[model samples]
Target: MLKKLLIACLLLSLIIAGGLVWSYQQVKSSLDLPVQTPENVLITVKSGTSFRGLLNHLAEEKIIRPSTWTRWIPRLEPELVRLKTGTYQITPVMTLRDVLALIASGREHQFAITLIEGDRFIDWQTQLTQAPYLKHASKTMSEAEIAKAIGASGIEKLEGYLLPETYHYTAGTSDIELMRRAYQAMMSLLDEAWQTRDQNIPLKSPYEALIMASIIEKETAVDDERGVVSSVFMNRLNKGMRLQTDPTVIYGLGESYDGNIRKRDLRTPTPYNTYTIFGLPPTPIAMPSKASVLAAVKPAESSYYYFVADGKGGHKFSKTLTEHNRAVRDYLRTLSK
Candidate 1:
């Protein structure tokens, strides 16, 4: 009887060992086997999705087999259960373990939108509306309404408020949210620049600095010339002279501007007409980059009071009207050639 009992115990232990080996093999095979598909597939995991629901969805799409093993593996591994909510691209050659690891790692698909320096507010609106990935909350809203939605209430205009940069976002990001981020970024930078501004600068407030920066942004594309251009404006402002900047006149002409700034356009009366006005424009004409903003508050120490395009993507600085007229003549001669 004792010998028969011992044999029974040995047979039971052998059966348990065999079952363990079979389970291990099955798990390994499931992880190593790739899904049967001809092309890559995009899987959108919505927020608040349960782990079981995600597994069921994968099984329904035939990316993985709907077996007890697949269902139990995630339940057994605590690290593989949680998933992030976003759009994920899955390839046909990826194994079940690869797909699970990819989703669990939370590396979701990213889309980008760029806000260009010197772009008008209307241009920003058009680009935001055309972006397919962003949720269009402000599509039909007016600029004022959009400003209010982004916590910038009572703003008469939206120009020059947004910081120019490339923003990355996922599928559910809203236009309003992007606008808010841009506004905050500009405000933060503007505040820092304003606090560190030069002593007794012409700019009285951060908004005035922003206005000057916008003009500087539109005036020159040369990165190193921004400080010199800013110095010209600062000198003019200190002497209580008219800005006489052509871009401000062009902005004032609005739709009536035919890509040319005639003498009559400069003489015309408008709030943005710095040619006739004695100070900065009431609002910014375009988005100003951080560099331009910094140049506005910290202009170079120079006596320059005027600048004109040198026909080489740069400008020639002058301290007197006679010198400026010569630079203007040189510019016209090149243009006529």
Candidate 2:
């Protein structure tokens, strides 16, 4: 009877070990199998989603099988499971383990919005309001209110404060957060450029450099002309000459401008009318690029003080009034042709 009892115990122990090995193989095979979807799937895990709920979602999407293993794996291996809230991209080739590891890593899909150089603050607001992915917090707020909310209350205007570049964010990101990031980026770049600014420049502060940069952004579309344009403006500033830039006058005209700048527009007395202001505008007219900002701080060494559109997507720079007038006449002759 004792031998029979020992034989039964040994047989039972072997059976238990064989069952454990079979269970391990089953779990490993399930984790290694690819999902059913032919294309990549985008899954959104909402806030406060439970682990069981996530498993159910995967089963519903047919990414994983609805079986005992699916239910038991997460419970048994809790250390390998981490659930997060955001949009995730699940590929067809992903295994159960790959999907779990991706969620655990919390690297979600990012949506992008670009703020173009020379765009006005209103344009930025429009893009933010139109982006379907962003969580709009200031859709109806005034510019002043928005500025205050973004910790920019000290800024007199919001036109040139934000940097122009592509910004990527996940779902539920607020407009205020995006704007704050842009503002901070511009501030950091401006501080760095100001620290290394050329000596004896007429700019009183970084704000002045920003004002000049905005003008440079509007003056020319040619990348190489930025430095020369900055030099022309700086030379004019040193001589107390009016900037005579059409964009500033148009900006001052605002809604009144009917796609034309008459002689009267140049004589306008608005704060933004550089043709009459005798210095940089009260604030930047638009967002400027990094190149324009650098040019503002370090203008090219030149004697040029005048420029006219050459009617070829570029400018004809001049060092004397006679040369400028001749270039203007040539441009006019081309227009007549």
Candidate 3:
């Protein structure tokens, strides 16, 4: 009876060892197997997704072969169980093991949103709304609430606060967080420009310089014209003359602007109309480039106080209204020709 019991115990041990080796081989095969995708595919691992759940999803998508052995992989490599929530790219060249490693590493694909110079805040909002995988938390909030959420409290206007640049972010990033980064970037550069500004500039504060920059951004797209345009506005400010810029009038018109600046529109009174107001508008009209901001603080030395489109995709600057009127006449003549 004792011999029989010993033989039975040995047989049980051999069976257990053989089962363990088979399980190990199955797990290794599952890990080494390539994902079944013929092309690159994007997969979103939502928050609170379990490792088993992710594997089940991959099997459902036909991205990987279904197997019970995959359960042992996470047990052996504990890090694979901590799935990171993000959008990941799975390619045909990737194995099931590679996909697991990528998800575990939390290296999600990056996306970019470009906020263009001279574009309005409304335009940026539109872009944010259309951006994929980004949480649209700002959609439910008011503009004031958004400003506060982004830690921009006490700001009268949200426009011109954010720097215009291509911002990169991973999936699940909030719109407010993106905006906050842009605002911080703008503040950093604005602060630097303000501190190193020419002391003789007529602008009182950095905000005022930003306001001037916004105006310059609207006036021209020519890189070389920014400094001269800054001089024109600065000279006007120093001489106590009304800015009389048509862009200000158009901005005040808002949705009512019929794509043309009429004589009546210029004469109309609005808070944003520089023709009616004595100084800078209450807030910036649009986002300005860093070059425009720099030009505002360091204006060229000139007596010029007037400028008009020269009919050649550029402007004609003049020191006197008489010269400006002549330039306008020449511009009109060119248009007729």
Candidate 4:
């Protein structure tokens, strides 16, 4: 009777071992098998998510077969709690392990954009509102409302609020957050420049310097000559002369001035018009870059008081209005030719 019982127990143990081996093989096969083809699915693994939850979510999406999991646990027990947060592009045939690896690598997608300094508040709205990743978009809010949402107070316009930089935004960012990031970037630049300002420069405050910088930025895109142009404007400001900037005149027109700037528009009277205003415009004409801001704070030492477009993507600097007129005439003659 004892011998018979021992044999029965031994046979039962052998059967269990064989079953466990088969189960292990099945699980491994399931995890290593080719995924279903031709389907590209984007899955988001939320922060603080577990590996099992990811697997279940994948199963629900039908990206991976449910049988893969059912067959997986008995033999090849995987640690289903180690997946990380991220946005992943999952192909149909990827193994569960491949998905985990991708997510663990944190391969979240990004949106690329370039924000140039000295761009106006309206320009920022145009760019951000059109971006797919930025949300909470509207067409009706005035510049002030938008500025307020971005956390700048008493803002006449968005001229100085938006920072210029190459930005990479994650998917589904709110407009307010995007604005906050840009605003923060601008502030950081401002703080750094303010600390290192040239002490003897003629400027009342950082804000005033920023305002001048905006004017300089709007005047020309030739980066190498920004300092020279800024010096000319600074001279005009110190001498109490009219800014005579076409951009401020154009800005004063608001929505009426189409893509063209007519002669009549220059003579029009508006509060923001620098051609008529004796000093700086009430607000900046565009977003000012750090370089332009620094240039305004410490304008290049010169006696230049006037400038006219040289018609070659730059301007000709002059110490007298007579010289400026001559330069303009020369440019017009060249254009006529």
Candidate 5:
């Protein structure tokens, strides 16, 4: 009876050891298997999601096969279970271990939206509407309402307030947040430029500089010509000459502009029409880039009071009307050719 009892105890120990080894093998195999995804996919782990909960979510999404071995991951590796809440991308070639490590490392995916220089605020609205993965919080909000939402209170217009650059954000980030960042960035840059501006420039304040920058931004895209274009506008402003810029006239026309600038458009008076107004328009006409902003504050010293497109992707600047007419004729001659 004693020998039989000892043999039974030995068999029981062997069975228990074998079960432990089998469980270890199963868990190891599951962790090593590739995630079952055809292409790269984004997964958002929300706050307060447990390790087991995430595993269940993955299984439901068919990214991972549900198995009993996966249940031991949290217990065996407690550190891996401390998942960070963010959007993560998982690829087909990634193993279960790789996904866990990625999530644990808290490396979230980023998406970008670019606001272009010389583009209108309305253009940015269209871009925000089309940008993927971002929450369209400002879609239904009016410009005034959006300005208020982004903490840009007292700002009558939204144009030229937001900086033109590429902004990066994670999934589910709000458009309002992005706009706020842009506004703050522009404010900071504007302040820095204002502090270091040439004291002799005609701009009375940062706001006026912004308006000039917007005009410069629209006038030229040539890298070396920005300062010279700015100089022409500054000279005109100092001499009490009309800006007579077509962009301002077109801006005043709004939807009435039908691809061509007619004589009647210039004859009409509006707040944005530089030909009609004596000084800078009530606000910036469009978004200005950093270069344009810098050029507005620190223009190149020149006597040029006029400029016309030279048909070579640049402008021909002149100090007198006769020279300007000659340049215009030359531009027309180029067009004729």
Candidate 6:
């Protein structure tokens, strides 16, 4: 009777070991998949959720069998807890064993935030707010909020800090995090550009250089004209002449612009109006690109003091008002007809 009982115990132990091996292979191999084949699926692991809850979610998603997990979890890992919060991509035929391994590894994803060169403030705000993964921005995301995100304080506008580039972010990234990355990148770029700035520049600080860069950005879409425009502005600055840039007037007029810069708009007084102000605006009027920043710090060698639209979205430059007005007459008159 004792021998028979010992043999029964040995047989039971062998069966359990065999089951473990089978279960391990079932999880590790794609051949055990009951469905078509391996498939891809996006999974989000929520914070503070229980391991059982996650298992239940996976079961509901049909990635694993409910009965199989319910039977195996207690036996395999009773002390298991939910994973850290993140976005994960899972595969079909992935069993509980493989899923647990993934959770432990915490492999997340990265996505992009595209900042176009010509995007307006509201346009950037819309892109940030519309991103579903990022936390909802507060109803009032003030310039201060934007400033602080990029390691600045008390800045009146978000321009210059909001770099024009494609940024990579994870699904777990917050709106502030996205803003922070952009600002840091812009700050770094500014430092690099400012280090090589011309000594005779009229700008007092790096901030002022950034201000000039934004003007350069708004003045021309053509890359080659950026340096020329910078030279024109610098010349005007040297002579105590008004910038008379139409974009500055548009920015100064705020939301009142009707798609046109009328004569009265130029004559109007506003803090942002370079036409009315003797120097750079109180703050940057728009976010500038790296190229624009570089161009501002290192203007082209020229005596150009005036520029006008050349009817092809570029500028006709001049060293004197007479020449500028003539170019304007030629270009504007040609376009109007």
Best by lDDT: 5
**Cα error of candidate 2 at position 316, Å:** 1.9
- Answer with 2 or 5, whichever has the higher lDDT: 5
- Stretches of candidate 4 exceeding 4 Å from the true structure: 1-41, 45-86, 89-96, 102-107, 137-146
Q: 1-337, model 3: which lDDT tens digit per residue?
A: 9999999999999999999999899898889999999999989999999888999999999999899899899777787778888899999999998999999999998888889999988889999999988999999888888888898998757888889999999888999999999989889989999999989989999999988999999999999999999999988988899888888888899999989988888778999988888989988989999999999899888889999999999999998889999999999999999
Global Cα RMSD, each model: 3.5, 2.9, 3.8, 4.1, 2.4, 4.1
Which regions in candidate 2 have their CA more than 4 angstroms from the true location?
1-20, 37-40, 62-68, 256-258, 332-337
| Model 6 TM-score (2 dp) | 0.79
Predicted candidate 5 versus true structure: per-residue lDDT over 143-234, tens digit per residue: 99999999999886899998999999988999999999999999999999999999999989999999999999999999799999999999
Off by over 4 Å in 1: 1-20, 32-42, 47-72, 75-78, 89-95, 105-107
Task: State which candidate, 5 or 6, has the greater lDDT.
Answer: 5
lDDT of each: 0.88, 0.88, 0.91, 0.75, 0.92, 0.77
| Candidate that would win on TM-score | 5
Per-residue C-alpha lDDT of model 4 across residues 1-337, encoded as one tens digit per residue: 9999999999999999999888777777776765554687677788877656666787787777777445355234545335667566778667766766576666666767788776777777778777864566546767677777778877756777677878887676677777778888877877778778877666777777777888888887788778888888777877888878888887788888798887777777788777767888777778888788778776788899888888778888888879878998999997898
Worst 10 residues of 1 by lDDT: 69-78
In candidate 3, how many Å is residue 22 off? 9.1
Model 1, global lDDT: 0.88
What are the models' TM-scores? 0.83, 0.86, 0.84, 0.78, 0.90, 0.79
Residue 214 displacement (Å), model 6:
0.8
Off by over 4 Å in 3: 1-40, 67-72, 75-81
Better of 3 and 6 by lDDT: 3
> Against the hidden true structure, what lDDT does model 2 obtain?
0.88
Which ten-residue region of model 6 has the weakest summed lDDT? Answer: 28-37
Q: How many clashes in candidate 6? A: 0
